[model samples]
Target: MADDGPDEAGEPEGPDGAAGQPVTPDRLRAFSDGVFAIAATLLILEVKAPAADERVWHALRHEWPALAAYAVTFLVIGIAWIHHHNLFHQVRTVDRGMLLLNLGMLATISFLPLPTATLGGHLRGGDASAAAVFYSVSMAAASAWFTLFWHHLCRRPQLMLPAAREGASRARRNSLLGPVGYAAAALIAPLTPEGSLALSAALVVYFVVGRRAPATRTRVLAE
Candidate 1:
């Protein structure tokens, strides 16, 4: 009898019987896209219009904080969506663990508008410090989850495409900046809410213009 090769004899499978099987990430990405879109859309709804009697320009000037918050939060969410897309583009398959981690990250993202509205409503009031702190903490939490997601992916290299492995490794290293920066912003919020927000904005700009690993071609596998 001829000797059977690895594929011919069937490679060893994981506990879930899916070790060597290729699972497409299309559905996961699509679902995540929907969540991101909904979350982004929800942010604008938090910006309410002025009362019927108020002068339009006066109301607009007075409500500038809400508009600013909306724009900032929208940009933050948009940037996050971009990062999510880039990260998932490197993935070849997902395990149950990855799915759970991704869900955790998405949960944080969905919860952003609450704190944003709070901050916008209080930016110029006596409670500005508290609202700023709350917003910073919320942002830190989201960043932490995103960092964990990258960490998890790094720990499970098999879930990534070969060409993307190097890029993923670099991303895992860069992911730490988010949690650290947001936490710092949280600490600064109590003393200076505007300064804290400035810091947060700086972090966002850094991430936007930061040097990144070269993009790799994704190789899709058969299901």
Candidate 2:
């Protein structure tokens, strides 16, 4: 009979000896990166101009709503990828649970382009309110999944590197900010479509520009 010990092969342990199958985050990250790329690529598909207009340039200019939608979805998904990198950086290994949560997040991410197109098409149409509601609801759901994923990572200290645990507390709380903003946008979407999207966009920009690690690392470390 073989003696089971801490250093045994095939029983690889995490930094904090968190119990789980020994799976690196690289494969998971690679898969997620592909999803993000596809979602971004799909955004441009809805930006086409309407058929047969006398003023070509003017017609092109009229497509601003589609362009705007593409830009907003692009930026939001870009931020999601950044957040994904930051998270997987800390989480050295993964188990079934991590994969499941990440899948949910990716599912929401993959669904973004559809609502983005819908919202853009309806922005200046009679369906604007309905479009705003649909778009905001989709964004809110995606935000929730992203927040849940980050919060799950924060809870598993054993899954994180020693240095990562320091920022875990703030990271958990910050993750919820995006979700709250999205939900607020959803609630107010019927009253004002443009205002709701503008608010959601502001939240996305604030999240990236405000909490960028280089500028804020020392503050978190000092705590």
Candidate 3:
């Protein structure tokens, strides 16, 4: 397969030419898409029906917070998956370290719904400390995984998409926000859990709603 270098369209070169060969990215992409689909489906399993009418109302009123958390995490995971897909689209081959990072990132992502449920449940129960700690730790772990993946990519820049230069820098900046916000949440978890959770929620909104200026992105890419 070493001699089967892909063409510009990511197709493998055949006896005829690169145009006739199947794209290696198809298999890898399919595998990654399967993992993402499973992860998204797993989120719904955490939802339980209310036992009483009052409970139903309570659940309805309270579900939004957890639902919001779920939305943020789901979309974030989706974005990362998309980014990963695009990255590998440009890559013709994978190495041991890259494979390891991909596996680890996928493993971490699979846990997102559990934490989202935990956050929603604890918040509704008024278990401020438990909820804050759970949510913060979950975000932190995901962020750390992202950081590890980005750092690894930086070390192995040749494996990345050619256009990933600006995108990678954007990823690095995005990666820092989660860890920093989660660390802050963790620090205040014991003393002011509600405050920490509020901060965390705010951070999530910022992540989803804000834009990274292109000028700064270009500068980072240049460096």
Candidate 4:
């Protein structure tokens, strides 16, 4: 009778020594948590406190634009982080390019507060052109980061989970919308400040509309 033992072929063992490589979701989770924490904390610094004034209404009125900008940027970043977390949760393996892509994404995330504050300052001061420019640039950088990261995942099928590809593609398109819209906005800034702001408004609508698509909505709900 033949004895059952290690194979002479020397194939690698599975996650539990069963068949294939291990999925390290924990490490991804831990790394994501840290990034999210840092990003969230950075958002607060963009939200300056209202000055003490003779009238509470006056103080709030002065700070309202900044507050609004801070809120919007914070929520957008939070949404991106959630999507990233979900995407990585399904991913099975990591590679060098994936690591670089993630680093680029993190780099963009770390810059969010600067542009948030820039938007806030310009909008509050009634410099529409500056606000539009800042907002557009920030959105463009963010979109580029998302595109690069997703491109890597899409190009390298082995790095992604089977169930996630369709959703990831949809999500990537959604992420790309911001930069494209902002690019349009920036182009119009020189000719029309109002038009540029209108473009910015269009970006918000695009974001909301993208989320409402049945498949993405359903997948988001499932998550």
TM-score of each: 0.82, 0.82, 0.69, 0.72
Each candidate's clash count:
0, 0, 0, 1
Candidate 2: tens digits of C-alpha lDDT, residues 1-223? 2232433212456788864454467778898999999988998999985677558788778887778778888988987887777777777556556777888889999999999999889989988888988887888888787667666656656666777887778877777877788888888888898887888788877876765642233221111
lDDT (Cα atoms) of all candidates against the true structure: 0.76, 0.76, 0.65, 0.63
True-vs-predicted CA distance for residue 7, candidate 4, Å: 26
- RMSD (CA, Å), candidate 1 to true, equals 6.4
TM-score of 1: 0.82
Give one digit per residue, the lDDT tens place, for model 1 in 116-181.
999889999999999989988888888787677777767777667777766666677778888889
Pairs of colliding residues, candidate 3: none
| Candidate 1, pairs of clashing residues | none
Model 3 local distance difference test score: 0.65
Cα lDDT tens digits, model 4, 86-143, are 6676666665555556777777777778876776677635576776677767767775
Q: TM-score of the candidate numbered 3? A: 0.69
CA displacement after TM-score superposition, residue 21 of candidate 1 (Å): 11
Candidate 2: worst 10 consecutive residues by lDDT?
Answer: 214-223
